[model samples]
Target: MSEMIDENAGGRVVVVGAGPTGLLLAGDLAEAGVPVTLVERRHAGRSNLSRALVVHATTLEAFDARGIADDLIAKGAPVQALRLFDTAVVDVSELPTPYPYLLVVPQYETEAVLQARLDRLGVVTRHETEVVGLRQDADGVALTVRDADGTREERAAYVVGTDGHDSSIRRLLGVEFPGHTVVASVMLVDAVLADPPSLRIATNTDGDKFAFVAPFKDGYHRIIAWDQSHPKAESEPVDLDEVRAVLHATLGTDFGMGEPRWSSRFHSDERQAEHYRAGRVFLAGDAAHTHSPAGGQGMNTGLLDAANLSWKLAAVLRGRAGDALLDTYESERYPVGTAVIKGSGRLLRAAQIKATPARKLRNLAMHFALQRPLVNRRIGFALSGLWVRYAAPAGAHELTGHRAGDVPLTGSPSRLFEALRGGGFVLLAPTELHEPAAEAGVRTAVPADGGPVRLIRPDGYIAWAADTPGAEEVALAIRASGA
Candidate 1:
């Protein structure tokens, strides 16, 4: 971690961590006209190990809202579907998303795109900067940071911690990371394959061991294997030979490795912060939650965290809403993060079951349950994150007080979200009735076949909607939401 910023500089919303989550939040904050300074413990624009490889549909849609997914796709691979080859080769293509297959992009490239976008939005990140601690009062939070050379103190109206699992911010806030760790430790290696296997993502089982491979750019592949029974010599560095041996033992054959790029050992831990906020400081991404990489959900959840928090932070900064809006961040996201951790952990347990008639029966039941389009849609909804619905406070109106699920809109702009690009509140009025919205100071967009009033938030969810022929009720709901 680098030194803190100078308190006398100016008012800045400090963001800790320059990873994808931080960059995305910074971009949103900048676009919302908030003065944001991102602090990273390393040099800026430095690419680290290419770890995460899958971008969920929710993340893709979130990036689409930011208009940066195309370039990311060009820089990485696109997986259109996932196939499970246990007992039967089941094609999970009919999942309930426009994006059924995951996006196979290296973590480094994803960060690059996010950083570039943040730069375009006029947000500068300070590298070699780390927050040592933070103190909060009635006004704001003061952060102590250590730079490459020295240390200093910086004061900010707000702080966001997007750091990894061992978050300094979480510690400063005294939040508990509650969860259990997996028994077996697994090693992951990224290598240039001499004969790269034609696999986008594969799970192969050999005897009691398993190897999972995911392809990446430049003929590199990330491989994972677990052989806890075979003890290794202490202090011996992991080499290509050892990696190849694990591969052969787990996958029945080794495709051969060129030069091993990166390798690390990790035991899965399913944990999430007790809370995401303390005084003027907030938490996002891994700082808020973490879990096993069962379905490649860590990065996806982190990205969604950025998306969810960014607009709300902007709302508070711009004075479009009250501090109460910020409180909803934890209420809305914490359960989702917990669900991801639990759901993925459950799947991992199911996968690790011994192959027997009983295990087969259990797997069959799971498969059958997932075979239903509605059930699969729910799973996809959970994975894609569209299913996240905030609990509206008591007495809040229905349509304008909660998020609107994506509904088919027969309109001029086509999709239901074409009218909400500026990240501002919008009031959709019936074309036949051009009455003023009830109380929300929002731009008016008439649905082509307008029959109802729809008030959408900047995050692409309908705050309050109604089938009424006018916008007055919708406006009233927006006002109820503190618009």
Candidate 2:
């Protein structure tokens, strides 16, 4: 038996997998004064071969809450429109948020920003340590992990597996990940294109092939190409010639692509765990759900999952809320995961239509729908994750569960997201209500326009709101939120 290390002194959280999801969750917890240990299987260094390539508007807003959005935005190109097929487009320029476009950057860049935050928070990340076994009881969870030295037991009050699709924590928890593979033998590569496409994001599909190209800040372009007619096994080696052939077939040119930095082949799966939580153990990111790469939502969704669960976990461990508050994590995120799976699956199926007539009809239908401003905005919002809203309790205000965008405030932190940087809730209300709101363990800010008193959760979602809220009524809502 491996020796056990009892580190559960102060409700320590052990976050498995140091990917963006795990890193963000750990940082959030640490920022909230929660002791968190981040463990990763990989060695102590960042990998350049990151799969996720775009950060959506919602994710940027989440980063803004942590004061890191500007750093990440400076590292990527802002794509205002996403082009599908030849005619259909999802325009995101008109979104109401401060960041209205998708920031196209490598996943490593995103991870770097989160890792830096973790470092500043004094959170320790144990790389090269892999979770091999897990067992949870009513009080806490025991994780068996292995590193170069040997296997040992690590204890934590709560465990979150932000590890990718094949999560060790989820597997040890005996959870069921039931879903199907959506795309097979998809080839991905990062290379320098001698003749780059004019569009920031260039994507097109012939009847038999599909290709997408988006640039990186370092001058390399990330390319994803699929040839349905000649489906290669994922184990087959992908070369520049094969990539060029598919690009040429779909985009009518290879754009002088060469000097491949990295290349790989893999299948995309649409899967979600049966439940995100089992006792003291929980799952986030790809461990909880995964879907097609269409819409660049995979990383974005996982980041949001971390954002939603972190504050709740902090509140529970800090004794501000009851354990039942933790249950809402899965309840709120599962539906969003399901929606992404279905929506992305529809996109992949549409893009994979092999028949010329079917392809033409798909393009025509999409083009027509996108031409309508409402339809275009809806699709853009969905893709950017700005349309996500949790279910509000009965009798709750209309704005409950909806995201509180960077609304202007009358206080020092002049925006709602800025107010969230203290790792607590914010009550935006009339100046008279500030006194009562302060007692609820939340920062108080007067709304610039003098609207209804709205209580915003740490994650930027509206928790409670009322046009005419008494002090006691506001206090009750805050206490219910465990703040």
Candidate 3:
């Protein structure tokens, strides 16, 4: 691993950011023997602010594919049931996966897990290195990086900007982040409440004000309160008194709130990048899109984006696939990003309803709808990301674009994700077809039911399915997957 930034390290792929998305990408690339370097502006030994707090089931399954899901689960607190609006609740204990509930852990804890995995993979992260500007060419892209010492230029075959919302690389690329700020001033703070409401989640609204309290693994709770009557700039300071007052005004009491830890103010926006790729450069995480924090979807979505792109980049660099393979990254993820932006924005709008009568009516409807077992199950599935499906090409197999969510592995105690640990597709067929390429990262498992052969992508999605598949069928699926 290259500890410090070296000049022109043989045209390695440069990942800009040390966040979870960038870490996953770099780790996956290096594990596949692709020379990659990660750059972050934060100083060494520095810790980032804890923002997002929920790691959804789909994301955990992605980590499971990479062989780090169990480690994260060991350190997180699971919430099987989530309370929303008023008396409505969503129980995800039976969400149909190895990880049935959303793991409630600070974003920093999630980052730490990725960091450790990167270290084990022998990936280096250069701190205090920021991407000032960049320009792409026919062959690759050139980045102008600034550090305390001076400025330098590094060329790479591809560059991915996984930086946060105020990404400098995204600005340099001149992509439009078109969206409006849904909330002007949102106050969020960490504190110890004498009377904690819920160990999982407590979210509700009173008139025009809303309050959400979620406990962390450290025995502290995060109080996110918003009052339309009190609009202030994000730069303004926040105080515990104000948090207490807002909680009291919105939730009828502060839950004996006191002993503030950290506080900040920020606004929520719903925006997505117009393009995920520009020449040899690509975007992921907050650089590609951003949305309101209503559903705790920000970090989870970014991690999934990294998972979707890492395999494609590794394939192209290793000469296993053609350049066109990279285009699928945008085509598949952009729609999901659009949906998250709209869905989370809609949730925020519902919570911020100004008219008291409208809010009451909406709450009544939600209460009735959530009471139905089918409706609750459906909501749980979607919110947990099990309902997310991709667009398949015309004439493709019926299950081509659907996820193979935790299928039982034949002749072992492991599941499908366990078979995908080393990275590549797993052929679940009824009989032994043929051995794939000696160098191909493919695994074969015969189902006990003697079902049709289904090609499962490294990201745990079905590429194609057929009653009988031979070497040619597997090769076609691999080519289509760019793996």
Clashes within 3 Å, all models in order: 17, 0, 0
Per-residue lDDT over 414-482 for candidate 1, one digit per residue giving the tens place of the 0 to 100 score: 554444544556666654433454334455566655445776766666676666544445545666554
The Cα error of candidate 2 at residue 150, in Å, is 1.5
The C-alpha stretches of model 1 lying farther than 4 A from their native spots are 1-11, 85-92, 192-199, 204-208, 231-252, 255-258, 355-376, 394-419, 431-444, 448-452
Models ranked on TM-score: 2, 3, 1
Residue range 1-483, candidate 3, lDDT tens digits: 112222354447899999989998888777666788899999876365777888999999999988898888887778888778777787788778888888888777888899999888888799999999798887788899999889988789899999989888889999898987877678888888788876468788875678888887777888888777877788998766777777887666798887767878888778899999888899999999998888888998898888888878877776667889889899999999998888887888888777878978888898899888888888777677788788888988788889888888668635788777867667886544636522355667766555667878778888787776677777677666655
Q: What is the C-alpha local distance difference test score of each model?
A: 0.70, 0.88, 0.81
Show where candidate 2 strays beyond 4 Å: 1-10
Best by TM-score: 2
TM-score of each: 0.86, 0.97, 0.94
Who is ahead in lDDT, 1 or 2? 2
Tens-place lDDT per residue, model 2, 1-483, is 111223445488989999999999998888887878999998888787578999999999999999999999989989898778887887889998899888989999999999899888888888899988888787788888899999999788999999999998888988999999877888999999899987778888885688999988888899998887788898999867888999888888898898788888998999999999998888999999999899899999999999999999888887778999999999999999999999998888878888888888888998899999999999988888988999999998999999989989875888788888957888898877777777655788888977778989889999998989898888888888877
